[model samples]
Target: MAAEAVPAPRREAWERRTTVPLVVLGVVFIVAYTIYVLAPWIPRGPGSLLFFALLAAWVVFVVDVIVRISLTPRGGRWAFVRTHPIDVLSAIVPLFRAFRVLALLRNVPYLQRRSGAAVRANIIIYGSTYAIVFVYFIALATLQAERNAPGATITTFGDAIWWAIVTIATVGYGDMYPVTAEGRFYAVFLMVGGVAIVGTASATIISYIGEKVSEVHARHGNSGSAASDQEKGPIIEPPGRAIQDAIDEAGAVDDEHGG
Candidate 1:
C-alpha cells in the first residue's frame, strides 16, 4: 500500500515543478512557429533555427506527457488519460503543438495564490491569451493547407485568420471560408475551440460579476444590521439596574403601608 501510494505524490511533485517551465517552452514554440509561418522567404539558416526550436519545444512536451503517464498509477492510468485528453492530444498531434500553451491554465502563479475574483480574473486573461494563440496557429495552418488548392478563398494569412475568427465564433460570415480538406479539418477544430473559449470566458465573467454583487449585498446587509441595532437601542434594561429599581419600589411600598 505504501509503495502504491508513493507514485501519486511523486507525480504530483513532478507536475508542480515542471508546470511553469513547460508553459515557458510553449511560448518559445509559439514564437518560433509564428516566425516560421509568417516569413516563408527567410534565409535557410534562420528558418532552420526556428524549425529546430519548434521541434525542441514539441519534443519536451511529448516527453513531459510520457513521464506523467508513466508516473500515473496503473489502476488510474485510464482516468488520467480521460481527464487529461487535451494534454495527450497537444503532445501527440503535430498541429496541436500550439495547444501546448493551454498548459498555462494549470498553474499560473497569480491564479494559484488566490481564489474567487483573482482566479476568475486570471482565467479571463489567460483564456483570452490561449484563444489568440490558437487562432494565430490555426490561421497559419489553414493558410498553408489552402494556399495551393484550386479556388481556395483563404490563400493569404490575413484571410485565414479572418476565416478562423469567424468560424470559431460560429459566425461563418460567408466572406471567408476554407476550400481544401486540410483547411476544413482545421476549421472544424477551430469552430469547437471558439465555442469553448467564448463559453468559458462568458461564464467566468458572469461568475466574477455575481461575486462582486454578492459582496456588495453582504456589506450592505452588515451595515443595515448595525444601523438597526443602533435604532433599537436597549430594548431590555440591564439585569443589575432592573433589580435595584425593583428593591427601591418595594421599600417605598413598605414605607407607605407603615405610614
Candidate 2:
C-alpha cells in the first residue's frame, strides 16, 4: 500500500492534526450529499458540483484509513480494515457517509469537560442531542431515497421524520415506509443507533441513582454515628452522673442529720 510507505510517526501526527478538519469535512460531505440526493430536480451543473463534493469527501475517508493502517501496531492495513468494517464501508458505500457521525464520540468527553456538567446530566444532554440529530439525518436520507421512488409512502419531510421517530422508537406504525432498499438500510441503521443510545442512557441513569443512594447512605451513616455519640449522655459521662447523684444524696443525709 502507498500509505504503508509513509513513516508511522508522520501518519500518526497527520491523524492527530487533521482529526478536527476531517470531522468538518465529513459534516460538509453529509450536507452536500443530502442536497444531491433530495434535489434531483436541480440543474446538471449543481448536481455535478455535489458529485465532486462527495468524491472529495470519499478521498479524505480513504486517506484516513490508509493513515490508520500505517500507524497500526502490528496488524497492517488489511487487518485494520478487517477489524473495522464500518470504516471500509463508509466511503465505498456512500450511503454509509452518515456513519461518520460516530466520530462525535471522540468529542463527547471534550464537550462534557467544557460544559462542566455532571456525568448523568452530560449523558442525557449528549444523548438527546445525538438522538435528535440522528433522527433528523436519517429522516433526510429517507426522504431523499424514498421521495421519488415508485409506491413510496414517504414523499414529504414530515412523513420521513414521523417514520424515523416511529422506527427508532421501535414503534412500527405502518402509515409510511421506504420503497427503496437504500432507504430501508438507513432505517435499520437508525434503529440500531437508537437502541445503542437507549442502552447508554439506561446505564447512565442507573449509575447516577446508585451514586445518589450511596451518598444518602453515607450521610445517614454519619448522622447515626453522631446520634450514637449524643446518646452516650451529657457533658459528664454515666459514671460522673452516678458520682454526682451520690454526692447529692450524702448532702441530703447531712441536712437531715443536722436538722
Candidate 3:
C-alpha cells in the first residue's frame, strides 16, 4: 500500500507538468492538420512545413506516451499500451494524432483526494472540460476524414461542428453521420465518450447531494439533542442536589393560619 501511494503522487506531478504542454501540442497539431487539409489553397512550401511540423508534434506525443509508461512503476508496459490503444492509433494515423490530447482528460485518478465534495467538483469539471475538447477535436478529425469521401454529408466545418455537438450530446438527429471507416471509428469514440461524461456528471451530482443531505440530517440531530438537554437543564451528580425555587415562608405561614 505504501509503495503504491508513491507512484500515484509522482504520476500526478508528471501529469500536471505535461498535460498543458500536450494540449498545446494538440492545438498545434490542429493548425497543422488544417493546413494539410487545405493544402490546395496554399503554397507547397508552407504546406510541407505544416506537414513536417505535424509529424514533429506526433513525435512529441510518442515520447509522451513512452514517458507515461515508464513512470507507471509497474512492469505492465505492454498491457498499458494495449489498453491505451489511442496512443498507438494516434502515432500511426496522421489525422488521428491530434486526438491524443484527450489523454490529458484522464488524469483524474491522481488529482482526486479523499474529500467527496472535492472529488465531485473534479468530476463535473473534468466531464464538462473533456466534453468540450472532444467536441472540438472530434469535429475536426471527422471533417478531415469524411469531407472527400463518397456520400459524405459533413462537407463543411460548420456541418462537422454541428454533427459533433449532436453526436456528443447523444441526440443523433440523423442529419449528419460518418461515411468512411475513420469517421465512423471516431464517431463510435464520441458516442461512448458522451455517455461516460453524462454518467460521471450525474453520479457526481447525486453523490454531492447525498452528502449535503446527510450533513443536514446530522446537524438536525445534534440540534434536537441540544434542545432536549436544554429542556431538562444540566444533569447533576447523585452526591449533589439540584437547586429548587426558594420557599415563601411568610405565605406558607399565612396559608396555615387561614386553614
Candidate 4:
C-alpha cells in the first residue's frame, strides 16, 4: 500500500525540528564545497573523503525534500513544490545546493523573534546575505570554469570577482566577462539574482518610507487635534460623561428646583 500523507501540523513540526540540523549541514556543505572548489592539490585520500562528505550532504538534502513531499497532503504536494522552488532545485541540482547555506539566516536570534517588523527585517537580511553569498560563489565557480579556457577574460580570481559583481548588478561593463559555457551559465543566474535583489531592496525602502510618512501625518493630525482642543479652552466635557456624572447632574437640577 502507498504511504499515507501526514497532516499539515506534523509536517510543520518536522520542518521545525529539522531546520537547525539542516542548517548546520548546509554550513558544512558550503565549507566542504568551497575547499573542493578552491583547493585542487589535496592528497587523493583526503580529496576522496571530502567528495564523499559532499555527496552525503547532498543525499541528506534530497532525502529531506522527499520526506517533506511525502508529508504534504496529496492535494497540496504540487503546491508545496511550487512554493519551495529553492528546496526542490537544491535537491535536484547539485550546483544550486550551495544556496542551501541561506538556511543559516533563519537561525539568527534576532530574525527568529516574532514581531510585526520581523518580516521586513528578514527580507532585508536574507536578500543582502543571499546577494553576497551568490556573488562570492559565482565568482569562484566562474573562475574555475573560465581560468583554463582559451581567450577567457576572467582568468584570475580578481577578474572573476569583478565580473561577478558587474554581472550581478546587471552592469556588464565589458572590462571583464565570461568566455566559457559554464561561466556564461553562472552569469545568467547572477543577472537574475541581481534583478531580484534590487527589486526587493527597492520595494523594502519604499515600504519603509511610506510607513514613516504615514506616521508623520498621524502625529501631525494628533497634535493638531490637541492644539485645537487647547485653543477651545478647558474641555468642559458634557455633564453626562459617565453614569455618575449624569446622576450628579440630575441631583443638582433637582436641588436648583428645590425638589
Candidate 5:
C-alpha cells in the first residue's frame, strides 16, 4: 500500500479587521495634524478643539501601534523594535513633546506593496509631514529670534505660524521679514529648505505618475498577449485530427462491410 502524504500547513490570512483600526488611527493622526497646523486660523475656542483632537489622535496612534505590534509575528516584533526604537519610543513618549512623527515611517512596508495607491498615499503623507515639520521648525526659529527684538512683528503663536507658512512656501512677501540675525539665518535656511522640499514633492508626484503609467502599460501588454493567444486558438491538437479520425472510422466501416 502507498504511504499517505502529509498535508501542508496553512498560511495565515492577512487580517484586515485587525489592521483596519490602525489604518483609521493613522488617518485620524494625519487629519488632526493638519488641523493642528492650521489652528492659527481657527478662533481661540476652536483652537482648543484642535488641541483636543490632537490629544485624541495621539492616544489612538499609541493604541494602534500597540495593537499592531501585538499582531505582528513573534520574531518580527523584536526585529522591528531593535531596528525601530523610535517607533517604540513614539508609543510611550510624552504628549506634544515626543518625536512621534517618526512613527510614520513604520507604515512604509505596508504601503510599498500597494504600488499606485502607495505612491499617491505616500506623496500625501510625506507632503503633510514635511509641511508639519517645516511649520514647527520655522515657527520655533522665528519666535526664538524675534520674540525679544524691539518692534519685531512675530509676537504671538498665530503670527509665528503665519510667518512659518509664508517662509516655507517661499511666498515671503516681505511683510514679515525677520529683523534679528538669528531670524535672518533661519529665513535663509527656510528658503533653501523650502526649495528642496518643493523639489522633492515634485519628484514624488512625477514618480507616482510614472509608476501609474508603467502599471497601465504592463496591464495592457498582459491583456493584449492573452487576447492574441486566445485568438490563435489551442495549438496542442492538430487541425486535421477530427477529419483523420473520421476517415479512419470510415475505412474501418468499409473493411467490416467488405469482410
Candidate 6:
C-alpha cells in the first residue's frame, strides 16, 4: 500500500499578526520608559505602567519569533538558525533586558519605501521603536545596579529611569552614581552602549538626508526636462535653408558665366 500523502506545511497565522503588534508594543514601551526616566517628578503609577508595558513587549517579542520560525520557508529554518543563532535563544531570554527587542529593527525596509506623510509617519514609528528599546534596556541596567547601595538615591523606579536617561544621553552627571561593584560594571557597559546608540542615530539621520536629496534631484531633473520641451516647442527641422541658399548662389554664378 502507498504511504499516506504528507500534508503541506502551512504558514502560521500568528506571523502575519506579529508585525503590527511588535511595532505598537515597541512604541508603547518607548513612550512609557521615556516618561518614566525623563520625568521622575511624575508619580509611581506611571513607572508601574512602564514595567507592565515592558513585560507585554517581551510577550509580543516571543510570539513574533515563534510565528516567524513557524512561518519560515521549509529548509530556511536551518539557514536562519545558522545566520541568526540569537533567534533560538530569544524564547528563553529575560524579558527585562533581552536583546530580542532588536528583532523589531526589520521595519527599516518598510520605512524606506514610504513617501511624504507616510514617510513622516514611518520615521516617527521607527524612532519610537528604537527609543523604547533603548530606554527599556537603560532602565533595566540602571535599576539592577543602583538598587541596594549605600546612600543610593536611585532605589526607586523613577530614580532608575532618570539614571537611564542620563546614562544613555552620556551626560554622566556625577550627582547620581552607582556605588555597588556590579552597578559600576553596568555603568561602564551603559556608557559604551550609549555611544553606539548615538552613532546609530547619526547614521540614520545621514541616510534620511541622502534619501531626501535624491528625491529632490529626481524631481528637479523631471521638471527641467518638461520645461525645456515646453520652451523648444515641437522639434520639426525645416528643410535646409543654408543648402538652398548655396544652390541659388551657384545658379547665379552659372548664369553670369553663360552671359
TM, every model: 0.73, 0.70, 0.67, 0.77, 0.45, 0.48
Write one digit per residue (lDDT tens) for candidate 3, span 1-259. Answer: 3333333456557778988887788888877777766554765353477657776797987887777778766755556666677666666765456655655555566445757766666667666766776787788888889998999999988999999888878899998999999999999988998898878877887887898999999998887877876686887655423222124566687899999
Task: Tell me the tens digit of each residue's lDDT in model 1 across 1-259.
Answer: 3334334776798988998788788778777767776777864363487767877887888898899989888876767777777688878765666666676565557777687767777877778877887788899988878887898888888898888888888788898788888888888888888889989978987897898999999998887777876685767989999999999999999999999
- For model 4, residues 1-259, the per-residue Cα lDDT tens digits are 1323334776788888888888788888888777876776864254487887788888999999999889888877887887788899889765567777677677788898876478789988888887887888888888888888999888777888888887777788998888888888888888888899889999999988988899999998887777775575775676557777888999999999995
Best by lDDT: 4
Model 5 regions more than 4 Å off? 1-104, 107-127, 228-259
Model 1 reaches what TM-score against the true structure? 0.73
Please report, in order, the local distance difference test score of every candidate based on alpha carbons: 0.80, 0.76, 0.75, 0.81, 0.64, 0.64
Model 6 per-residue lDDT tens digits across residues 78-184: 55546555555545444232444455555457655756646655656655565666566656656755766678767866777788778878886877778787677
> Model 4: runs farther than 4 Å from truth?
1-10, 44-47, 107-116, 228-259
- Greater-lDDT candidate between 2 and 5: 2
User: 133-246 in candidate 5: lDDT tens per residue?
Assistant: 666756765775687799898866678888878877878877777788878877786788788878888888798788889989999888777787668677675759978988
Give the runs in model 1 whose Cα sits over 4 Å from its true position. 1-7, 16-21, 43-47, 102-109, 228-259
TM-score of 5: 0.45
Screening candidate 5 with a backbone cut-off below 3 angstroms (N, C-alpha, C), the clashing residue pairs are none
Each prediction's RMSD over C-alphas, in Å, is 10.8, 8.6, 9.7, 12.2, 16.8, 11.4
- How many clashes in candidate 5? 0
State residue 139's C-alpha deviation in candidate 3, in Å: 0.9
TM-score computed on alpha carbons, candidate 4: 0.77
Candidate 6 backbone collisions, by pair: 30-132, 37-161
Q: What is the lDDT of residue 60 in candidate 3?
A: 84
Error in Å for residue 1 of model 1: 18
